[model samples]
Target: MNSPLPPLEAPTQSAMPEAMNPSPDRVYIGFDLGGTKMMAAVFDAEFNILSRRRRKTRGNEGQKAGLERIGETIDLALEEAKVTHDRLAAIGVGCPGPLDLDKGIIFDAPNLGWKNVAIREFLEKRYNSPARIANDVDAGVYGEYSFGAGKGARCVLGVFPGTGIGGGCVYEGKIIRGTKSSCMEIGHVQVLRDGPRCGCGLRGCVEGVASRLAISAAAAAAVYRGQAPKLAALVGTDLKEIRSSALAEAIKEGDTVIEEIIKDACKHIGVAVGAVIHLLSPDVIVLGGGLVEAMPKLFVGEVKDAARKNVMDTYRDTFKVVAAKLGDDATALGAAAWAVASLQPA
Candidate 1:
């Protein structure tokens, strides 16, 4: 291979005189619909964000209002970008989903009280551009792979532990989707037998044991028993207010009970990730979400240690485990990039 072997020249008039005026800089819209918040963002061709908008999901208002919020958020983001809807090339949404991807219909998202919603059609009709959808974690992982932590790796597996543990993988530069549907619900994979019930009505799942909700429940119980005075003093007994930041503070104050709870959760996540590694053998395993961000070293240490213990010795050092780098923008950023990739000619 040659390095720095040639210098480029501008296009000749007879060859391509109209190249610059052929098209506008394509801008894409991305929406991240989660249990607690809904965020919309606008991205230039290179995925640099131009503008964004955010609001609570308020799912109790029902699907109609939720759908309206999606549109409104996107509209406001586009307005901030100073890009009219007509100039929009495409749009994508990353939502809590087990979607019918071919039709872009979300099957169920209990967090949002949404069922069988045709999101792609709605976005396309409203914005007059093409649209696509993916599970929020799926979008997030892809975003990291394309532009953040996992970049340049041949394969990337992402596990995000938040309200739930969501997962996704980018293999050989393409998002992995099953023949029948978009799979990879890593959070719902079983971690314990006959354990606590999950939101999906399943027992002993990873989400039931190690997700933020699970940690919050354990903290609430500890506070009720007067075992976690620091957490109680910091956030009260309300599980909703016991966020990762509060947990981090409790840990900073040397709350053994809270640290043990989070460590246990990280171990469960590691077991699940280990299983993923044994099956997929991805080059990189990226951990993201608010929990990991707030307490990164702890999460990284516990997860990598557990994963190392669970995997075969030969496969031990082949994968690097790290925390997500893009922070909150990953899901929305990935959705926009995925939309742009989908629109390109094969």
Candidate 2:
């Protein structure tokens, strides 16, 4: 379920000082389009957040309505920021699912039931501003690379384990990508030959064994077998009730089995990270998403250990595994920053 939206308010005094703030006309919009919810944020050229608005995606409402809702969300944000559309410099969006990046279209979002979504064209036509789109995970990793956990690193890898697992990489300040699509699909990498089927129809993929949904399923079974009494008491055997925070609470209440389940999942993720290490050798690997947010210490510690353990000794200490710092704002901020960066003259 999506979290409640923050109450709308005017730009705070924490905004950049007048001297450093960009010209009134130099504002940007960054939108995060997720499966459950979507958010729109306005930022100054310096990237200080000005205002934000959030809304449920309501994917069942269909594509036309969903597009309308996205526009409305952006309008509300621009209104709250007291910045008119005329002042907007450009717009950037971080979107989920397979994308035709060169064409700025989301090719498919199984969760949202959206396909061939011409998000960039919609934004540009609606606001009469230049627009760009990228994979949401790529935007998030870029956000961390630019200002959060992976700051100052030469290469940063981000792996987010949520309903499914998502991965992104930033090397030398540029988000690494294929010629026409986003790459670094770590979750789709096979970990167990002929293991359980993943949502992607692939057997033994990392996401099949290690995503939050996968973990929740495993924990729910423990609840059914009467192993996770604390979790059972808190949320019963319903898979929908086994949220990330709830799992964390169960572990806190001495549910050692539940903790073990999480560790095992993180270990799978680490195995994937170890493979990436052999290829990119990133300076930092950032673990983000609700699962990591709810149990940062355990996830980071276990993944770190497992990753180090699986890799060659010579490659040990070559990378640091860390948690994301920007929380929910990472995608929006990163999308906006990417807009500015991508638009710069070569």
- What's every prediction's RMSD, in angstroms? 8.1, 11.0
- TM-score per candidate, chains pooled: 0.88, 0.91
Report lDDT (CA) for all predictions: 0.85, 0.90
lDDT of 2 at 27: 92
lDDT per residue for candidate 2 within 1-346, as digits (tens), equals 8998998897553221212223555899999998899999999877899999999999888888999999999999999999987778878899988888866898888889988988887877888777889899999999999989999899999999998899999999999999888999999988899889998788999999999899999999999999999999999989999999999999999899999999999889999999999999999999999999999999999999999998999789999999999999999999988877887766
The lDDT of model 2 is 0.90
Give the least accurate 10-residue stretch of model 1, judged by summed lDDT.
Answer: 13-22
Candidate 2 deviant stretches above 4 angstroms:
1-25
Query: How many residue pairs in model 2 have overlapping backbones?
Result: 0
Looking at model 2, the pairs that clash are none
Q: How accurate is candidate 1 locally (lDDT)?
A: 0.85
Query: Could you give candidate 1's per-residue lDDT for residues 115-226 as a string of tens digits?
Result: 9888887877777677888778888998999899999899899998988888899998888988645777788888898989998899999999999999999999999999
